[model samples]
Target: MEPLRTVTVRALSGRVGTVGSGDGGVRMTQLNGKPVQLKEEADEPGWEVDPDDDWGIAVVETVGRQLKLRREAVGMRAADFGLAVGYGEDLVYKIESGKRIPRPEYLDKADKVLDAGGLLSAMKEDVKKVRYPKNVREIAKLEAQAVELGVYVGLSLHGLLQTPEHARALFEARQPPYSEEEVERLVAARMARKAVFDKSPVPALSFVQEEAALRRRIGGTMVRRRQLEHLLGVARLRNVTFQVMPTESGAHPGVDGKIELLKFADGTAVGRSDGAFNGRPTTEPKELRILELRYSTIRAEALTPGESLAFIEQLLGET
Candidate 1:
């Protein structure tokens, strides 16, 4: 096995000191009379709290108070606690003061360090939802409960089917451009929506993509090849039905734009069409009926599931 790497912090005019090789996690090493943590991985996320998410804000604040209370109860100062938990003192204060969202891994470390018997770690579920954008969480919640989902995208691969590299490339190409952190966050959220495919009893997922979308090569050769390969795999899933709307079969109902319809086990459904009803998702039976009709027509015009998989495989070979 490779040796564990160590980090030295503020060693100005001072010799290094101390040791403890943790379970391949952040290890404590003393230097310059200050406690330091060794590098482990890219910095954990969930640093910033969404300003518009009131419920998420409240959850973060509650978790922060718990962390603060537990640390204080054990008579550990902020700096001491930070050293023990493998983070900076200021970061600890920020999380405790409700100025930042704490990452799930951090909670696990805190739970062990504070002897909370999994209480701190258990808070991960609550904090997990807060880490994502408000709109994303709302969408994810709907997808999680949906029993049937139908999506049509004329321009790009739907979020649930996109590879991380493809999604990152798309995000990076936006006009205003997203920061590295925001790109990572959005990608993570998109990936989480895929959990719908893994839900117990599994949701029946149906996706329709334009032929041009498959041939566009969005994320360069290797990335696009991987995406096409992934699409083939997903297409083959028993519960998933994928189709491609060939360009040659023009003048289709999908020409208006994207369509998304999600039906629940309770018989309730929500649908949205870019060209209809101002593009707002609606639960009204009439609106949903219209969207469903258009979707059914589009699906009828698109290539069959078997043909779609063959089409994607050909694209992969071309790459």
Candidate 2:
């Protein structure tokens, strides 16, 4: 296999700022302070919608154009402007060219630097609406359109079914960790996906969770207790079903890990697995069929929805 390529951002005076993977070979550029590394193959089909679809590109373009105009009006060169914003000249150029999305902080600093009277800062909200990383937005969109959804979770509560506190705790526990702003953005996006539960025509939702997941104290005693109580409440939903796969049900299909299958009204479907198919979500019928079979088997091995509620209650009482 070929070695991964890297890009090293450096200052004209010979100081490295940041290093990130590049498409095919090592490349060097000048930039200010360190910024997060950019992925080589940024867009993954089916995982994320095209940036052009959600006014993402247009918003970036507008913001970039405004920044450039303001900088030119102030007679500031890219390097000087970048220093004012605590970023690199290359990054400033990237943002101005609409090739990069400026972080909220970057815009705030730029606004102050250019003395734009809050104009740049005002773009933060618009940028945020279209700037989710990875496949989060796409997954949320699929969940929204799903007429019937089946889930098998081995380690944690599904995002849609989580309460705010539970979801916050989960995001906070991620490795490398997310910034406060990032955590808030993620939590808000996750919560927004729950709107499907209240749709005019309710969707059919089913979940099979490993027993261990229910017992795990993710966010301390009180948080765990509240989560259990919340689960019980959601279990009462008329259009939802919940089951607990006992630990004793060893050697189950779900041992491979989490699985999600969503069926839509138009006869199209999508499925995702943590263990198979390269872990990428797929819309292929054959892949969907396999995931459905595994999910069905996991559900079969789990306690009935009624029993699952009782199981949760038992755990709650123990807590």
Candidate 3:
């Protein structure tokens, strides 16, 4: 009888391919004989293309065509090309058929294999933006320049403040369902938005989270614990002012839905709320004031910054 020992390997997943246990990249561990193969949660296979993105679609198709042409010109079949590039033939086909987005690494590999002379690699800039959802890219663009951001979310934590595990779970729980690829793409995009917190001067960020959003128990016990811990960390940031809106606080303007306000360094601002003005984004000063007033009220009703951090710490302790 063989006494089993666990071994771990770091690789990408979410795309089934030829790898450990024949499922692309598996983080195999914890077994008696053969290792228990587990999916690696970290890694974005570029991103699934948005159906509504005409420009993105065109770019993908053009690059894919170039890849197929280059491979053919080099006298390599899809399988041969896939082997040369270290990806599954099926994945290679998906990329060439424009059914899947080609990752940066894939482009680099393809460029080398097909001898495209850095032509394929240069497409990464366009491909990178195409990978994320259109709305996510737009929101990220707005966040990049905003000097102040005030956000209120009643049902869940804001994307910018979510941990990868927490964000992945949230996306996985969506209804009507997203494909495995879609989920990873979304999670990647959401996490990418967190880059706003890393800007040079850092933005003045404020978040008012409903008490229930904190207690919702997303992604199970460990996930909840980690989320609470992460939330506490973000809430403690010097530039961030976080508040917890207790259910006991009674009715408030934010009870209608989520609200987001971003004020730019140039004195321009954009505001949006699910409950107000049909949920369309607005730049008008009068409309912005209404949202501002509502947000102020919500912040007032929420637990103070110090109190919120303490309350979350208490929750984390229980978890």
Candidate 4:
């Protein structure tokens, strides 16, 4: 049995390949037990893909490269690494090839197994930085990557479900005007994040909304109606759960702020405390725990899924 190592090799056998491990885009190889160092090879495969300019592709490829490098450094083949990480070899290949984003558990195992010095975890933050709207970048990135999302929206609609008309109205209300082009770019990016809804093994989504959010006419009657309809459609998704916190229910923990909790396949969790207009704020362990407790408390106080939908329908009928 060859000492299994996970590395992105250059094939060295024709068709030059790019080297990398996970999100870092840095590659490593070994020659005679000595770690072979690789640079940011502009000549590596997919150099033409332009990681810097294309936020999503660049971040995805970077993570894949990092995973490949660290795996090889440990002298493990993709199958061996996947087995250790409790994933199928095919899944490992998908992650390394940038065809799939890794589940949180796989990344954690890789972190310890590869002795990656927290590089894998750091890539989560790096991807957030790549998305526009610097403030909600983390939320956008995480929402796009999460396998399950537990979210509370106290203000307006969540970004993913907001129609272009609603999004534009909200953005235009900003103190500083966003140029038409900037608005379009942001909207395009937001819509792209919704791809998660279509991801295979679609993530379980639970959205708890405040009654006020339902009443706030973001883009006027027509826009609000469309937004409500959209929510109705999404709530009906097989993997989605929708709840509403009634105004009559009285003061709850979320009264202070909006929050979103992302639970990855590995059981590790991260959270955000800001809305789309405000940049997404990362939650540390202590903070994440606090939010979790608050979320549990609030969910307990909110309406049931059946009641919530009826409530929304009642509101829609009124308007």
Against the true structure, what is each candidate's TM-score?
A: 0.75, 0.61, 0.70, 0.57
Clashing pairs in 2: 31-88, 32-88
CA RMSD per model (angstroms) = 8.5, 13.8, 10.1, 13.3
Candidate 1 lDDT at 194 equals 80
* Local distance difference test scores for all models: 0.80, 0.76, 0.79, 0.69
As a whole number from 0 to 100, the lDDT of residue 156 in candidate 4 is 82
Best by lDDT: 1
Write the number of the candidate with greater TM-score, choosing between 1 and 4: 1
Question: Stretches of candidate 4 above 4 Å error?
Answer: 1-131, 274-286
Clashes (candidate 2): 2
User: What TM-score should be assigned to candidate 1?
Assistant: 0.75
Question: Which candidate tops TM-score?
Answer: 1
Ranking by TM-score: 1, 3, 2, 4
Clashing pairs for model 3 are: none
Question: Which residue pairs overlap in candidate 1's backbone?
Answer: none
lDDT for each residue of candidate 2 in 138-243, tens digit (9 for 90 to 100): 7777787899999999988888778878888998999999776567656766776687888879999998988998888888899899999989988999999999
What TM-score does candidate 4 reach?
0.57
Error of 4 at 230 (Å): 0.8
Instruction: Compare candidates 3 and 4 on TM-score and give the better one.
Output: 3
lDDT accuracy of residue 5 in candidate 3:
24
